[model samples]
Target: MDKTTTAAPSAAALAAGRRAGWLRELRETFTLAWPLVIAQVAQNALITTDVIMMGWLGPKQLAAGTLASTFIMPFLVGAVGLISAIAPLVAQARGARNIRAVRRIVRQGFWATIILSALLIPLILQVKPIFLFLGQNPETTMLAEQYIQIGVAMFIPGLAVVVLRSMLSAFNTTRIILVLTLAAVVVNAIGDYLLMFGVFGLPRLELRGAAIATVVTNLFMFVVFLAYVLNHKRFRRFHILWNFWKPDWHHLAQIFRIGTPIGMTVLAEVGLFTAAALLMGLIGTNEIAAHAIAMQSASMAFMVPLGLGVACTVRVGYAYGRGDDEGVRKAGWTALGLSTAFMTVSCITFILGAPLIVTIFLDPDRAANTDALRLGASYLVVAGLFQLVDGAQVVAAHALRGLSDTKVPMLVAIVSYWFIGLPIAYVMGFTFNLQGVGIWLGLAAGLAFAAIVLVIRFAMRERLGLLRRTL
Candidate 1:
């Protein structure tokens, strides 16, 4: 009887097979996540360096820079979300071994980037009137306008880098991304110093100088990454740029269809934070400066989970393309677990080291910094409180993206952040007089809500019919 058909594998054997599968998946996820994590941290380092230098220029300039950033980030991050559609799309094509599809998706990603940049640049350039209308301090608004005028030039190249980086991430060629970003950090620092200080005979442009440096760094990154993608032997075979001027309206529309919700989702969340910043602006210059420092600290820690979330999208997209339900489950859960664990560590660190972290951005010895430093430390503790939920929400949202499930998540974000989060922030900070900390508490509440809902949706993917492929 063919040796009894080798007997159905014992329960123990099946258990061992599962254990091995989990271990293999964990390894793969870690490999993919580490480079992305480092790259993200390095990218943030570029921003942090600017913040530190801004602080050196004094609290007033720091506040101005923060105001400018709050305005710029919503548009920039939302556009990055749009360009990031290339990742899941390319990963799925790769999973199906469809080379032409990969090229088309990437080419269209570039198209989306260019189009978005054109629309956004004009809007961002009008920040002066917008901020003035919003009742921002006239002085800070003027300074912010000065900074943004030059910085907005980075918009196109910055979005282009997102498209290229998304393509590279899907292909698991992230080490080069890491190296390039790290180099940019150094380049940006040097540029910031020379131009901001007028060192080495360079003219001092101050805040405008910082903006120029950032634009140069972004342009450098885009040019180098594009060249690498076009010439690298591994990627050249796809001929992503071969058509140059041809349009793929189908894939272009597909990118917008999938990406618009993602951009809106990011905008909703970033908008909430921007609203909070505006609230802080209403409070005082010290509050705004403190909020900026605390936000930068939280954003720095957030990079790890964000990187893991991105990796999850690629892994889950690949599994979904192969129609391997179990693979998708493993990839998603493993990434969730890893992100949660890292965030737990970050939470503890923030709670215990808030003072130290605050001091990094503002000098405790400087009496001028006293109020901002104290407020920053307190805000950081609240940031710690929300860290876990923030990590969980990001990973869950990204996992859903792997399944091409974004529209519902966009609604979730709008409801959670705008409907639930912002009102609480306003009422608590102003009506209840809890001040800045209350605003932060509201942010925590929103993230916790998003975390719970999105995780539940992902957990019930099969039941909710979210795993069905629309593409």
Candidate 2:
């Protein structure tokens, strides 16, 4: 029982305790992340069903729908980013056990959604003129406009669903979100079949029918989720909707204050891809086709990290709200590690299965698709190279969001994607003649830069004074 022997046992016990704590955090992160991941996949399935059904109408209809979707997505994603602020806010409130604050935050989230929809719906409705100004074909623009007219109606409901989903996510009740989203996918598919093709004695509505189906699906999700939130024992205690009409300008403005930069950050990343597609178009038709196939594969792989990022925001926010600095560190690092591990597997898949993935999108036996297939396989290789950094950047950004740090991340994204990545892309793709490969390389460069910067920022949180405001 000398001093050295006693110290050894003490140190060993401390180490064991730390390991147990980390194991618990890992379990909690996984439990929260899986359902969110499945819900994300289900949401993607809803969009995929629309694309498949549009293809049934003919190439022209498919093209129009693609154009409309391209036009609408930036707005939709940006608005969702704004609404996403609700998650961290509600999570923090829950951790603080401030039920009144939770209700006020959610009420303001709904308000922000309404305000954003009002401002955005009109702008989206002007897609016809905007596309025309962008020099799109008049016929295709008209067709896209037709779909958008009805499709824009879903905007409000869609944002409302985000508000409700955010609240649920903060409570660690994401399973219902998954169930609802999967059900919506089924509903949307059936609606598309019956309306788009005039099945079951229905009149053929073509592109409009698809749009109508999307609107109905979104509305149904919003209404049903609202009902559940209102009536559920765990949720109704907060009385989130009891004073739905009363304005909480303070929280509303806080949402915008924290969320606008987030919205801009999303737009910046999206704009980079949109610009990359335009660059691919400048190269050749085969390149454009290849880019589309490769991008779709990357996007599908990205959903996992995106969902994990959402969970990170909540977990980290909870720790921040509780004023548990060690908890915050554990939550953030656990999520980053989880995301990195998953993306590592995804990267290996992309590297090893590029050709197989390309074949899934384009037939190898078709002469017309041969070039596109080769190019798509090459692009997937580049996608593999960027996978780790992409996952890192997203999770890091969300981790910072949990600490209410967004403005700096937004600036980092803009500078990385536009100034650093885009310039390299232009020089390599056009000036150096690397073409599609060069563009993909540029994307990797951008994501890597963002990942490095954001991760460093998170690591330096204490020195940067990011934890000072934590309750």
Candidate 3:
């Protein structure tokens, strides 16, 4: 054979192999992200399911459901952050081929979650009355109390499920979370249909029924998650605390050592949105209602970026474990680029279809809506600008966490949400009289600042061997 002619086949083969590898990576990323994405969507659907079921019992039930849900957010998100300490830890352990450490991490997470859940129930119970005193109507206050009692009463089962789900995600078994989420959604929806409306021999319980459905579904899922995690190859070695697994003060210290700042990080950022929603309530139910509509739309766009953020943490943690500087850089860039591209398209769609999006939450007679149609449209329009920055900030924060440099980004959030975001929203909305859109615009500024600083910090950490130093 002629030398050049013979070499041509090898070149072609190499190119084909490269293409295949790229395709495989893309596939793996999609597969891993798909479960998380669906889980998030269904989780949102579960909330919407409550709202939809309550819509039948008149405005009071709907209003009560939304109001009570706000008090539940701190525990949910903060606990998720605390559980998230397992992901990077598991990823690094997986990369190092240390299955035992990963198992220990997950089991410890579950045991610790139980203690935290116990602590949280009373905090919410005591403060429930305080929220009621924050100038609510008589009817709304009564409904809010009922919803809170049912929901918080069910917090333990719900809390166990999330912590276990996080453990599954840590070992790259997101499929279990997706399955559980789907099961939970379907069961909850049916329970809402039956119990809320008194179908299928169930009594007409309405909002309380929705809460009970959630609790029952969560309980069912906790069992399923337990079964799957035990069967998982990565987790099979560790016993599931058949004996006493009391709170290891030292391990709890370690968890909170890593987890507390991250928990505060979640609390600060989500707290901003929750507080903004409450402030919107001050302006009018119209404003609060419109804000909810816009938020649902934004959350859809958020899923892609959110999935990217998860992937970033996994890749960053793995690269950091291997001590591969170049791999770490490539992983971060790839995650950011992919996330930004997908999210930018989603944002554009949201901007263009804001009204159509809002209409889902309304009817022609508009029974579910209390606001003008134009309000949600206006909110989504301004909200579009923030998607890019929001995507940037979240992905950056995830990457930083992957590198185990979580504190700086947490600090960035503190400044962005409190110092810059909330103050600006208050000034722009009430002070300047712009209201809902003004508040979102204020949030956009916070996201922009968070995005810029986190990206800068990521670069600094990568160059300075911050991951190496931390590990």
Q: Could you say which candidate leads in lDDT?
A: 1
Instruction: List, residue by residue over 31-63, the lDDT tens digit for candidate 2.
Output: 999999889888887777776666555445655
| Model 3 bad stretches (over 4 Å) | 1-28, 55-59, 242-250, 367-372, 469-471
lDDT tens per residue, model 3, 162-248? 667666665668877887788888998988888888887778877777878888887888888888767767665666554436444
What does the lDDT come to for candidate 1? 0.93
Better of 1 and 2 by lDDT: 1
Better of 1 and 3 by lDDT: 1
Runs of candidate 1 with Cα error greater than 4 angstroms are: 1-9
Q: Which candidate leads in TM-score?
A: 1
lDDT of 2: 0.88
Task: Provide the overall lDDT of each model, using Cα atoms, as 2-decimal numbers.
Answer: 0.93, 0.88, 0.75
Q: In model 1, what lDDT does residue 268 have?
A: 93
Global fold similarity of model 2 (TM-score): 0.94
